[model samples]
Target: MEYDVVVLGAGPTGENVADRTRAAGLSTAVVEGELVGGECSYWACMPSKALLRPVIAGSDARRVPGLRQAVGGPLGTEAVLAHRDEMTSHWKDDGQVSWLDGIGARLYRGQGRLHGPRRVVVEGPEGEHHVLTARHAVAVCTGSRAALPDLPGLNGARAWTSREATSAHAAPRRLVVVGGGVVGTEMATAWQGLGSQVTLLVRGQGLLPRMEPFVGEHIAKSLTEAGATVRTGVGVAAVNRPDPGGPVTVVLDGGELIEADELLFATGRAPRTDDIGLDTVGLQPGSWLSVDDSCRVDGHDWLYGVGDVNRRALLTHQGKYQARIAGAAIVARARHCPLLETDRWGAHAATADHDAVPQVVFTDPEAAAVGLSLAQARAAGHRVRAVDKDLAAIAGASLFVDDYRGRARMVVDLDRQIVLGVTFVGPGVSELLHSATIAVAGEVPIDRLWHAVPSYPTISEVWLRLLEGYRDGADGGDGTDDGADGGDGTDGDTDGTDGRGGRGQGG
Candidate 1:
């Protein structure tokens, strides 16, 4: 079978790619070995958030004065899991498949591998082989999987990765989570709230090392306060499980041993390119595919890499963003039209992946940030200022959560007077991140931001406080001008754990 586009992996990224290509009247085919909706829908984003919402809601309820009494009991774990299962369509992809069919994209059910340039060979579940050829472009969107550490006794041990952590039938009595990234912290929060005694072991100095130093501090404090053991500067050396489904014994680097009913290695992500037959196309089978800004593979005009497989911004939303760009580029090239708007913030270019990528880590006190951090701006040689405001000072925050503990930081480019990045680490702050993303990506001027007033008495009021602080500090005009805005644009987008983005992508 030949198509204008053949997409490997039917995740959100692949679906969007096929959707766009087919909308452009290009024949598109999508192949998947797992559920059609991919990781975000089945495991990472959707189900995980489903598990987290109740926890967050309960926590929020407890913070409010009158509502606290009603929610003073443990979360119904059975109901929570059931709700999550429902949100994921009970792991069935029928709806997703139907949506694909509606979009006029062919769905090939199998394990697909690149047979050669612009060619994909899929081995169906029953070992049937089907060769698919792409007339215009072959897109690789296999996404990523948990990267387990090479530890002894791990193979036999029934360890939980993100998938198992989110989909388990019941919460374990004790959960040990390794890695301090988004998955580790979020899952730790979810299970701990659902009545599990969570022990979060981090090899680094603190949680969320990629964000501001205070972010890790705040999350660690809250996690500890919530009856979870937050231990930092600890490394896992080995795993010992005598029998499957038995207890897991994790050995630390200094010979310390910890026992848990379940162990989750939220260590990191590895590209799902290993078995995709990349070697057949002269590329390393296990390596990440490099792509240009349009998500097209390097040195291959007919090849495109979208989503986590390309190692570009790894967040699902970012992957979808890349897919749109890739699709547009594909359509433009195939139709012999001028590839206009390939520039930054253009319809055909994914400029947001560079700095305006937004992420929300759904812990009790959500952590969200976009654009650059103070350290990132300094390293990038931008003359910037970091202005911080205590969210407790905002009246809306106090009304939202009694004794609200959160901080907001705004990083501004001094020379240009434009906001480089913004971060809000507190309860209900996730809703405030998109404004920051717009400010950074649009390069909105600080003086202009002062006029874009936040609604009165909302968590968004923190924006006003930050702007006032920035203005007050600037007014002082002391001889020492540390007045550079505080905020850091992460080197990699999506908190470095969820999504991966490379420098370039092509369609």
Candidate 2:
């Protein structure tokens, strides 16, 4: 098959790229090895979030009518499974395929490997192989897969990565999560809420270590209260599972053995670019293809890389942003103009990404934040100012519940009077994050932010308190600091998570 653009993965990013190219009057072909919607749709984000959605909405398999006996609370197992199946279309690949065809993009159902720059070989289902050539460009958007850690006795055991956990019809009774990051926390909370006894083991001292201490503290407390035993600053020294349904006993470094029905390693992910002909395409770092600022691959200007394969921020939204930039950049290059870079807008230019990428941990009393933390700003050579507030003091807190327990903080550049960081933890506080995200992204001056009034008798009103408190000092002055702001978050942006740039993001 010949086309102007051949997108190598039909995930959201690839779909977005192909759509953008088609809209620009380019003939696009999207090749897929498996499900067209890729990992995010079938396994990662969609199914995982769907599995946890009902629990957050106060719906669970143990809570439905006539199915109450199967669970301690009230859910119809059949109905819950029905909902999941409906959400995933029973693992059907048709929705994505139809969406591709609807957009006028030809779809190939086979594994495609790069044969050369702007060239690929497709191993088809019927055992036929075809060489597909693209006239303009080829975008790599293969995404990533669950990473397995090298642990003693962990091999050949009945284990579940995110894929199995998200799609499993029945929950494991005793689940041991091997990582203490966001994925582990969410899965632990979800399964525990659905009646699984969860034990989370972390190599760090706290949960959500990437955020402010206040945020991490609250999440840890919530997770602990939710009945998930969180063991921090510890790791697995050994693990043994004799057979399926047998106990998974994990021995800690200090000689403690923790047993569970199943072990889920939410350690991280490995980009799925292996054996896909990256070596034939010249050089880059790691196993990922190195791309320029405009998402153009190293040697071949027409070839591009997006999503996890580029080794940028490994988040779904970040992947989408890359796709948008690459698509736009391609058009710009065709017009004989310079392509946009990461921080400047033009073709495929997404500059704010390095400075601002926001996400939220959806546990109860959620934790959310954006931008550089205090230490990060300081390390980056910016004068840093950090202020914190507890939810109990603010007027909004008293209104939400008499005893709402949570905290918030904002980091400031003393010289610039612009926000450097923001962190919020409390019920409903997640929605208020955009103001902070905008502040950090826009570098909005403190004076202008003061006019952005938060509604009254709500958590967001704490913004007023924060700005008022900044006074003379919280923005980085001597003693004019104000710290009276606190709330459950009456802010209007949807719920969110963070870093001192790389420091915050690495956690």
Candidate 3:
């Protein structure tokens, strides 16, 4: 056997697994044909945030130092894109290669397929063949690609995916988007900031339907205010890209034709688990090596799958989380160490994946949430209560934007007295997610969380306000704890006494 572990696709998750396995004193080999950092590092999150960070800085700049603009100014589109490419090493795959070598894991630049249990056949980039036999495990972490919709004329025309939009050097005069999900919304925000006349066509009533409605509402407002036209409940009927810089016309089902220089499909992603030799190992597409809390691939206990390839939630963080656990699981199996488990860690073992995977849309008035929404929670048979606040009323928002207009919400499990979910949508609120995530994951009781105080004048103060409102509303004109609110703090987030002081203010 060449090694103890063989990991396919050297994306972030794959790299993590390889690194972890190596640290456990096991020989590991990583196979890759593309950049190791994967989509998020090169195209999606890194560059997208690069574009937004400047807009945020410029907003602060124009607000304080330079006068006469509501922070609306061109952000040197070409320069910003050039910087993005530079950060990505001009889409070069070498930077990742160097990192892989530094980690002491063997690297194979090739197309890899499972020949059988513990065996893989690799077709190298230069057409060389190598067979690897793993003494312990083989893992699939292939990630995913943009899912294309079967819209008429979609393929026949010059359309873009998240890949093109994120790495494109040239900016279009007008841009039309086909989906209103996270990728679509964030790309729309980036392009709009970079001076593209942007139009978003959504199939739902609002963008970000998966996040809370409050989040969707705030994103719609912020995008609209920033001069982007959003049309919902409309799917593209057809596309026609006839000539150079000619308008790409998307005929709507409702007899409307939208024109733009370029069209982008921000539809969701599909796992890249095809033709990787799953069948030889008794695996199927949807059933590709199912695992338990130990992430052990079913049937073949030594085989593992991670990242977007498992048809799991396609977030980079989730991928890395799975990789870390898988690596540790490998170590545990080798040393006969009792498996270390946590909800967010070993939780990768089953179909309960969505129990609390946090999703964030990094737009202006950024939206983020974890766990189930109100409807989802109720349908899952939990008595639910929700508290929503116009962020404008929170000290956090008032301090951040003086004329603040944002939205937030917290969902509580009445029986559990813990936050099942929470959301924040506004400028500079990205860092506020950990509190909610910790609360939900830990299932922290409402009262104990009161001791987990948020610093003053921060957006997290909204957490205190949300608990207070739920407590007040649950009082029902009389203070009583019938476990009625089932809120994260409906019973104890606030002291029953009305003494709202001692959280001294800070910016």
Pick the lDDT winner.
Answer: 1
* Per-residue lDDT of model 3, residues 403-439, tens digit only: 5667677778877788888877777677877878888
**TM-scores of all predicted structures:** 0.94, 0.87, 0.88
Query: Which portions of model 1 miss their true places by more than 4 Å?
Result: 475-507
lDDT of 2 at 482: 41
Give residue 286's error in model 3 in angstroms: 8.2
209-231 per-residue lDDT for model 1 (tens digits): 76877887899999999999999
RMSD of 2: 6.6
Instruction: Name the lDDT value of residue 185 in candidate 1.
Output: 92
* TM-score: model 2 vs. ground truth: 0.87
- Candidate ordering by lDDT (highest first): 1, 3, 2
Q: Rate the local accuracy (lDDT) of all candidates.
A: 0.84, 0.71, 0.72
| Candidate 2: tens digits of C-alpha lDDT, residues 459-490 | 88777767766764543442213433222221
